[model samples]
Target: MIRRVLACSVALVAVCSLGGCGTLPGFGDDTTEVTVWLMRNSASDDFVQRFKHGFEQEHKDVELDVRIQEWTGIGEKIDQALKDGDAPDVIEVGNTQVPRYAASGGLLDMTLESLRDWGSDAWLPGLAQPGNVDGMQYGIPWYAANRVVIYNKDLFAAAGITKPPKDRAEWLADTAKLNSGQNQGIYLAGQDWYTLAGFVWDEGGELAQEGTGDWKGALDSPAALRGMAFYKQLQALGNGPRNADEETPPQAGIFAGGKVAQMIAVPGAAKAIQKANPRLADKLGYFPIPGPTEAKPGAVFTGGSDLIIPRRTAHRAAAVRVVAALTGEKWQTDLAATMNYVPNKSTLAHAVEGQAGTAAMARGAAQGRATPNSPQWAAVEADNPIKPYMTSVLNGADPKRAAKAASDRITTLLFP
Candidate 1:
């Protein structure tokens, strides 16, 4: 009986070993261990865990090492990692920062062949544009988010507005009626790049033109001057708050608190807004941004994380697999529903249910353009001399002089 029991135990061990149940691939043999560096946000953590578990279950021979870093420290950490020779195999980077890293040779060169093999083109067109520097791909879009106009239906009804605006004129008129001593019609972040960029684009003016790498001050143009004037008009008429900072909670807080009728906000903000005021969960209505003319509908700026492979990685093949699984249809769809973000891939639409508003927002994102992908983009935005100068124009400064001053400053930054 003892001999029979021992034999049965040995048989069970052999079965388990054959299935590769206990060992990760490339552990003892030539198996690969890939390290993934991800942001330390709550949503990102959940995504990383789900992706790691799923990939590990399928590819039992592979080992995944995940390192989470706070968003504030990511840039410094990545720079330090590269110098220390401890760079991760794969990295998750913000869309805006992707260009800076790629331009500095901090990422692997992903060619069309690599993208095709990995099947990354399933995402939206401009969604993955950030990972490309000088037309060579360096990253895959993991997920995407964009801004939209969220309005209170009850407020609109109370203000006697028949419907949401389709053009700039109607938008202004509606805001005028919605404006009350207790409630502003719109909640605009004063220095919000996303909000400013929408107005800039609507006026047929670009912050910077593509390819030539020239910076002409479009902010001083007649069209841009007109747009800025309109913006100040709203502020003067009490349609929006004064002295609201773009990066703080109060901008979104007031809107969520039912003190404002309409506001420009990100898709990811929906969950937070609903959390702030539970009653707002079903009362929110979404609409595409209105522009000066139907021919030029205002464009929503795209914002999201990109999946990049580091040049120093030893597990290139495995890293590619990880990116594929993360950006796959199943993951994209699941993430969109739970996080209120749009999926990177167009095919993942079916994964999201009851999200027609998000779908419309996605279409707007596709039509949008990214800010100049130059390495100097950060410096320009940080040292934006244009804002104060534009403020002068809004307060009755000469339009041409304001445009020229802004243009000159931008040109110096771009060319210098």
Candidate 2:
């Protein structure tokens, strides 16, 4: 259910005027309502306002009913609603969650011809691939987030480091200097799969690969084993809790506490850190997590929302139009400028490159990879098998054993 209104955030936030059933101008009782449910943080008021106004102009016979929904319990809520045939016309799903819904036949099949309106070619492959299932498109690329190294400049200077690490080896070299009394090196949020995926991709390894219409876990490969080793070494280099899960953002408070040297996170983390400890605001810095090579950063995994339409929607055509207008080139540009997020359209990503977060993220995204696109991937995430496995490895388990067990668990989940 739609609950709570987040007060004005950005300066250009549009004021939404409440419209009663019969109060809407030019819309009458015959007007069909297209209810759209979106998480409060997914879109800005100004962008939604423009979409509402613009869509109305295009479809005079349809009334757009926009509701702000909370992310908490959203998965259960959407699942229940969709199963009960009471789902909204259009909803935004996390990129990773698209598989679960699409594979379950909950979303409408948006064929390639129907998707050109949204500039399909402009989409970042990592952001768009999750929206695809069995060659059919069920979602469109929405705004995305990639990791960028957010560090404390004061800590770096105190540690005698004059420049950020150009590569992972350099980063590891600086850890000794940073990990002194009361201070630690990079604050590796142990539960963050996206950050871990970067190391795997950097080492030319993959978590899973599709074969014979099924995804097989490939973490046991030589390259992946190296990646796993590097990932485990990360925890030992830091002082943060090694047993944390995705449910807990371990870096938030720790970074604010003013001892951790660096952390890999979305651009919004800087805001969160400042909120936790305002005094550290000016001392913060941002950059991409350098890869093994000096020319590029590690391959960061993309995290963002994707727009999907329910199969049972009474207005599929209207929903498509609405999404196209909402994610229009102009609005997307505004989304990046105002929200500090990477636009779904890579073409527009350049516009936001000047922003430190987007710049660092863009550098990483050029080499980034999306999570394996499969329905079972969602189940794997919910189970969080890797977090525990990582914890075990950090506690002294062999990388090969942990990887093999993880692969077994994944295959069991996917097959069962």
* Top candidate by TM-score: 2
Residue lDDT tens for model 1, 95-194: 7777777765767787764467656666665566666778888878777777777888889888888677887788888888888879888877554556
Task: Give the Å error, residue 304, model 2.
Answer: 1.1
The TM-score of predicted model 1 comes to 0.82
Which residue pairs in model 1 clash with each other?
Answer: 25-61, 26-31, 217-407, 220-403
For all predicted structures, in order, the TM-scores are 0.82, 0.85
The digit string of per-residue lDDT tens for model 2 on 1-416 reads 12323343221133223443343344345566889998887778987887788778877777899999998889889988889888999898888888888766888888664465566766777777888888888878778788888888999999889888898888888876788888888788566666777788888888888889878787777888888778767767787677885336657778899999888778788888899999998998888888888977778888888889999887877788777766668767777777787877766767686787776776666665688887778677777577777777777888788888987787666663
Model 1, residue 407: what's the lDDT? 72
lDDT against the true structure, per candidate, is: 0.71, 0.78
| lDDT value for model 1 | 0.71
